[model samples]
Target chain A: MVVAEVSIVPIGEGPSVSKYVKKAIEVFKKYNLKVEPHAMGTVLEGDLEEILEAFKEAHREVLKDSKRVLSTLKIDERTDKENTIERKLRAIGIE
Target chain B: MVVAEVSIVPIGEGPSVSKYVKKAIEVFKKYNLKVEPHAMGTVLEGDLEEILEAFKEAHREVLKDSKRVLSTLKIDERTDKENTIERKLRAIGIE
Candidate 1:
């Protein structure tokens, strides 16, 4: 499994962007991937290709309403063991 | 031009991972991309392809020294106008 954190920003969209973020979240949900939203970005867990596909879908979804879209993706894939958001946090003693 | 914020973490490397981060930053610098290190990640400004290439290089550099690497990239690209880190923060009144 891979964990990806993604942030999509629509330029010139004024200050509020929660609506765009919500749209991206909906895309992730539709993909049936585990999603966790945080202050900076949203974390997703799924197969590597599925996560990338979801990221692209979310980016495209957000871009539809805005003139310019800027998106970021962070991927964490492990071959040694199963990795998840909760496990990552707990590893650092966050929970 | 584009602005990318990247964070690479080497899994199972305990709590301190600054050394790994430093390696990534060096790759960005070597690529001659403008880089700004932040609390959460590093912001880079350069051509989109260059930025992506540097990201890959950084990821590989860090991966060489660790077992598993997890990296995150956030890109802000604009075709309407030039985009930079300062302008982004200033747009939101951060000065």
Candidate 2:
């Protein structure tokens, strides 16, 4: 599983960006993806397969109107590394 | 410890916002705070004690120029909720 945080900036096409965002949400729904939509970007959660496909389609559609898009991506993999620490501590036989 | 994602928008006072951001960073540093600075806002990670103070100061500085400050905040507790499920499953005798 992976999370993709994507931001789409519009140049001469603010409305285009809005429309693209709405369309992207609809498409992600088709794939049963989790979406956290923001004013300027979206935070989506799903498996790599679903995320990659949906993101690609979303990117492509927005890029279709090149004169109106500036896309930025922020990716953060939310994982708890604490488990590794706990395992190591347990290996040392410490509670 | 808590992570606070704060967005500071400037009204007629964007430069004041920029200045406030810089000053705010300095103030946070004075108290040893972690900051993630973005174009539109900042993401600060610290204990509740540290974050609230810096944020309040930051908020005050920006609001000083009432004709030029708009502030927005977003908070997310980035904890792995999956762990609870994993532990429950383990107790139920599943991997």
Candidate 3:
């Protein structure tokens, strides 16, 4: 499983970006991936290709309204061990 | 408190990016931020200004060797609530 952390920032959009974020969340949900929306960004767990596809679609969705959009993505893929948001926190002794 | 999720990617760099990532992590550690390094990127918790300063320094550090670098940052600041990695996971019932 590939766990991706993504944050899409719409430049020039006022301080409030809940609308764009909501749309991005909708895209993530459409993928049927397990998503956890955090204060900073959203955590998604699924196949890498699916996650990348979702990212692209979400970027396009946001770009439709905003002139420029910055999407930050971090993908974690491990063949030896399964990784989830919960497991990552557990590895760091957060629990 | 502000929690920032940052991922620095050096474009054109070969598949191995551990060196650049290590430098970035060193910068994060120097700021005395509580950092949790995961598979994709590192999660940093500290004051907003301090986190931004660290990000700049880390970006510079990586740029010394790579020509093009992409840094993605997400900041989460909530005046009404104290947020932490643990709290975030707990909010989603991960724990």
Candidate 4:
């Protein structure tokens, strides 16, 4: 399994960007992945291919609304062990 | 200031990717940004423009050696307050 954290920033926009984030979250819901939204960004857990595809959609969804967007992603994939959002948090003692 | 977490994954490469990661880290060191290399990825603390530019360079650096690269970035930028890697960890009681 693969887990990724993504944050999309729309440049020149106002300080508040919850609306754009909401749009991306909406897109993520359409995919077969677990979504966790946090203060800094959103975490997605699923297969690597699916995760990357969902990320692409989410990026495009936000880009349609904002002219300039800077999206950040951090993907963690392990072939030896299963990795999930909850498992990662549990390891860090957050879950 | 902005703090971003970035991860670069080179596809089709063997499971071991430390070499590619090392190359990207070297590029990040050339900028005036604070670099914190963690288990999963690297955290960068600096201005938004500088961080983005540095990210672009780091991405290119990794891409040069790898045939296909998948990069992930999570940027946290605040206009009202200063944000650093240390402060972020301290907030979560990691420091």
* lDDT leader: 1
lDDT per model vs. reference: 0.82, 0.54, 0.80, 0.76
Off by over 4 Å in 3: A1-3, A6-95
Pick out the ten consecutive residues of candidate 1 chain B with the lowest summed lDDT: B73-82
lDDT of 3 at A89: 55
**Candidate DockQ scores, in order:** 0.43, 0.04, 0.17, 0.14
Backbone clashes for every candidate come to: 2, 1, 0, 3
- Tens digit per residue, CA lDDT, model 3, B1-95: 88778888798686556678877888999996888776467789988889999999999999999989999887877676777767765553445
Cα lDDT tens digits for candidate 4, A26-89: 9888999999999998888887667656766676677677655667777665544566778778
What is the C-alpha lDDT profile of model 2 across A1-95, one tens digit per residue?
45566655556763223455665566666775667554334666667677777777776776776566666654434354322223322432334
Give candidate 2 regions above 4 Å deviation. A14-16, A66-68, A78-95, B1-95
lDDT of 2 by residue, B1-95 (tens): 45455655556742223455566556566665566454334556556677777777776776775556555555433254322223322432335
Sliding window of 10 residues with minimal summed lDDT for model 2 chain B:
B82-91
TM-score of chain A of each: 0.92, 0.61, 0.90, 0.91
Per-residue C-alpha lDDT of model 1 across residues A1-95, encoded as one tens digit per residue: 77788888897689899999999998999886899999888888887667767876787677678767889888877657778878988999998
State in Å the error of residue B10, model 4: 10
Ranking the candidates on TM-score from highest down gives 1, 3, 4, 2
Candidate 2 CAPRI category? incorrect
Top-scoring candidate (DockQ) = 1
TM-score of 2: 0.40
